[model samples]
Target chain A: MLSIKNISKIYKGSNKGISNLSLELHQGDICAFIGANGAGKTTTIKSIVGIHPFDKGEVTLFGTNLQANPAHFKSMIGYSPDTPALYPNMTGKAYLELIASLYEIDEGERNKNLAYLLKELTFETAVHELISSYSHGMKQRLVLISLLMHNPKLIILDEPFVGLDPNATRFLIDEMKSRASEGVIILYSTHVLEVAEKVCNKLVIFHKGEVVVNDTMEHILQKASLDEIFRDVTSDD
Target chain B: MTKLTLLFLFRLQNQLQLANLNSSNKDVRRHAFYTISGYIVAFLMFLGYVLFISIDLNIDNNIQAFFVLISSILFWAFGIWDILSGPDDLIKSKDRDFIFSLPLKTWQAKLLPLFSKYLIHIGLTFIVLMFGYLVTIAYIDHFFLAILFVLVLSLIIPLLSTNVTFLLAWVVRHVLSIIKWRNHVTESIITLGLFVAPLIYLIRSSASVDYKEWFIQASILRYPLNEINSFSFMQHIILLIGITAVTTSLVILLLTAFHHLVSSQNAVQSKKRRTNAIWHTHIPVTALLLKEFKLYFSSLTYVSNTILTPVAMIALNICILVGVIPNLHSFSYDVAGFTITAQHLFTFIMFTCVMLTTTTSCSLSFEGRRIWIMLTAPVSLIKIAASKMAVNILLFLPGIVLTAVVYAAIFQVRMLDLITIVALLFFSLLLISIVGFFINLHFPSYTWNNDMEVVKQSKATIITAIISMITIPAIIAVVYTGNLYLLLLIMGIEIAAIIVLLQKISCNNMMLN
Candidate 1:
């Protein structure tokens, strides 16, 4: 359960980001936050995660205000950046172990998740190698593993499937569903419409930093195809 | 008179800082600024020798001046060219191949940089010399002609070197594909040029105090610039022009050769990874450091930065202290158990080790994009910071101790001073390591396009190092002025301050560092 109330970010000394946008989510909800590049999706997500400050909005995780208690909220959420910002010098296992240690996961849960993620990602062999030597796809998988290490309640992913292989992509979609079914809320964002249309339970199309649509998949689909709606929303630009 | 394609070469020199840097490392728009600032700072620091040395009709007294000035320019020129062009030269995009596939000739693209380089070179130096000659000095026999000669000399040197380096880049880029000795050879050349030059020149010049004995090989610059016949200024200008014309012609030839050797179809084939000599050191942080170490070590830029650069600087100093320090070569070894070299070396070694802790300062900031993983993880913020601190201590401790011990063995360090040096060194590292982390944490500029930008250009790191370096000496001064009990009190105050600062910084680090 994540809630954003009137969230707006104005970068200092520069006029940027959206204004007065808000959203609320619940567990098992697969919300697709759709926007083109620079449509304030990142700004909203960052505000929720306490990475950047917002000028006119409040973000709360499980009824705890992010501003009032950031560390508490942060521990309960998993955020994946659009960019794979990995420590090039760190090995896959070293990185995973670092995440595990930080989350303060006990040895058993840490081992189980590390093993499961590495196995699922087909990275068991390569996880011992330094992340710098890994290709783009491998880095993406590692970030996913780091995000999933703690199994936080709400998952916020920014363009998670950008560089993944088709098999990895399939595994990701299935994993999101399974995780959601187990009562973890998923907030997946992408520019691609088809993936969002097929997987997301609730679709929220963002245009000009305001929510243009938010409903169950069938309700959003009743108006138009996801592609048609995306065109309509972006056509105003 | 036909125009020889001169664009007031001296004017270009005035605009050198036009390529100045913007302070923000994250923004790529300011790269032109970053690069040019680096170039100008490095270039101007070198030209200090030029300003110090008088260049007159008497070239003998100015021989040291000439050597220092010309070599400074060449050193900076090579550094700048390498800094500016190396990266673009390394990467050949699919689009570049496509462009080359078109009717456009390779010389058109390659020759443009060379021509512009001549403008830049003349622009870089000639104007300053001209200002000195025209505004400041009125002793010129032929002011106009002297300016012309300076212009020619300026153009010729950079033109000659840029073309040669471009040719070398093609060769090194290609040769590296087959054989990998390019780095070794290049480094050897730089080492000889920067460090061994004075020794070589001293020996050669000292042997030939009488010019007639070495008439054909009196000086490298004299042979190159023909400043020998300075009685007639026009002849001097003509010779300078002649050299430029010849060198330009040679560059054209080299460019033609480059066009042939570098085929249009060529792409930088991914290099085969080296496997011959793997490091087998079993260490805790080994896996984490191996990738960064390999990335930094294998690449010339990083290798020079992290290890080779400092070691090379130390080696250069060793040669200077051993060969040419004013009185060290013939100095006394015992003065209450202190050698002349030993005192300076102890202070120097301690300064260097504490400074060495700075190697880890930017390591975290370098992980700009990936910092979120550390932030979101269950690992306490302190552990993450400690891992980085450990790497820095890992960077600082051994080298410091080893060098101190080596110097101790070589010199008569009284046990008291040795203890002092050891205490100072450890405290210095402790102070440096903590401040280094806090600097990066508090003002972490993680989003840097250039590795040099993170290490060298980070303001936080530089300021922190300066403050800590200053603080240690200031504390020592205050402590030494008082009794041992007072020294203990001061150390207590420092430790208390550090702990408080650490608490405050670590508390805020989740946001800042």
Candidate 2:
């Protein structure tokens, strides 16, 4: 279970990034955070990932205060940034190993998980090659493999499917489904309402740094499609 | 084939122009100007020195110097070529992907730029050399004949320099193909020396060159003033023309083979070759350390900067020893100590250089936005810092040792002094590692795209290194004599103890965010 209380992020600038907000998320839930460009989705995610600190918020992850043991909290949550930063010179395997080593994966288990993940993702011998040579889609597949199947409390990503081809996207969608079956909380941010409608169990519509609605798909949809719901909530802002 | 080389060369010129304007690697642009400007100033200085020296020869040094300066101006005219062509000619840049898949031959792409850039490089440097000759021409009685001979000499000099540079690198590249151990050994040595060229040169220039003791000198160009202009011009020209043509042919053949070599290097990166063997087990910290090391070493730019320069130091020694760079400026052989040998002096230079090059000073800057990865990864920040520190030490050790051996040989020092020097260098290295850690920690430039900025502009690194260099000799002097060794031991303990103190400070800093 994840709970956010009194999460008020007032970004006072030409374009504010976040404002007073509150929400709760739980396992076996795929929460789609939908917002337009310059909306608070990325900023909110950045704060959660500790990439950027929030102005004011007390986040509690699985009953532990996020700040009390930030590293431990982070280690239990796998994050894939909008543009995944892979060491260009590192091979797919090498990059994965670096992450795995940090997550403190055991040798035998790491090998097994890596093999299974790579196979599922259809990564070839190119896994051993330098990522400097990898295509954009290949880089995403590697990051996806890094995030999944670790029993992480939360899986957070920003536009996880931006560069992926159709086949890779389908494979990724299927992987996310299986990951969710294991009671993992998946928090992904995207601007595509259709994608959010299809993959997400819960929907959080944010505009001008405030969450207009965050509830189950049907409840938030309220006799209307996500696109209509999005238009209604975001139009005034 | 030459026609193709010319066409390919023109395209490279265009590409180079783009690189100068657009290279994300900013130093590539700056270094191009620096090399050119350094030549210009150094040339002017050289002319001034030559003019002063010529006065004793009863020659009108001013006229000679003025002519020499003009010759230098003519040389700088080639800077148009270099600035137009840029370092992008030599380096593989961001645009290679678009160019690589094109219908062009690989040799056409690679050799044209390599050949053209050097052509310009020689032009720039040779102009300076010609300025010296022009000054001498003004003093000579046969001014017309001197001018005529000098023109021929000037053209041949750049041609000769370009041909020699191409041939030397070609030979080294080929020899590397055949001699595996030698290539690695040589590369390591050059990488080590890159850390200390100025220091090595300062030490060497300060020391007296011993002509009778052949092994006693690291510079082959000893007494450059004695023979800078004395070589038979016509005879050398005839000889040089022959050498240039022959070398040009060999280089063309080498260019033909370069395609295969680059493809092989690419295959290793692109085809997913097997990694070097890894141990079956590793602690988390060790694993992270290995990853950081791998990241640095595998990078094309970093590897070139780190390993290639030190390994190439052998050639530098040869150049110095052979008097390749004409002594236009007054120089000395005074290094750390007058008693220091060429080999030991070489070591000290590499030691300082490697310390300079290892670049723990900017590891934080290198992190960029990805610093959160370190913060989030659950690894101890100190371990990350330690691994960075360890990588630098391990990488520099081989090159430093090579320089020390060479220095020991040149100085004819006993084993004891060598041992003492090693101990002193070792402590100095330790002190630098600790201080470098704090320098980086105190003021990390997270936005730097260039290692040069990180290495050069990091105020802490510059200030600390300057301070260290001044204090090192004095510390060694004291440490060698009395209870200073105990003091050093005490100092090491204190530094180790300070890690705790620093951790508290860092924790507070981390809290501020």
* DockQ per model, Cα: 0.27, 0.42
How would you encode candidate 1's per-residue C-alpha lDDT over B266-355 as one tens digit per residue?
A: 223323333222112222233344433433333344444444324534454464446543444354445476443434544554455455
lDDT of each: 0.60, 0.59
Superposed Cα deviation of residue B268, candidate 1 (Å): 9.8
- Report RMSD (Å) for each prediction in the order shown: 7.4, 8.5
TM-score of chain B of each: 0.63, 0.56
Instruction: Provide the lowest-lDDT 10-residue window in model 2 chain B.
Output: B211-220
TM-scores of the candidates in the order shown: 0.70, 0.68
* DockQ, model 1, C-alpha based: 0.27
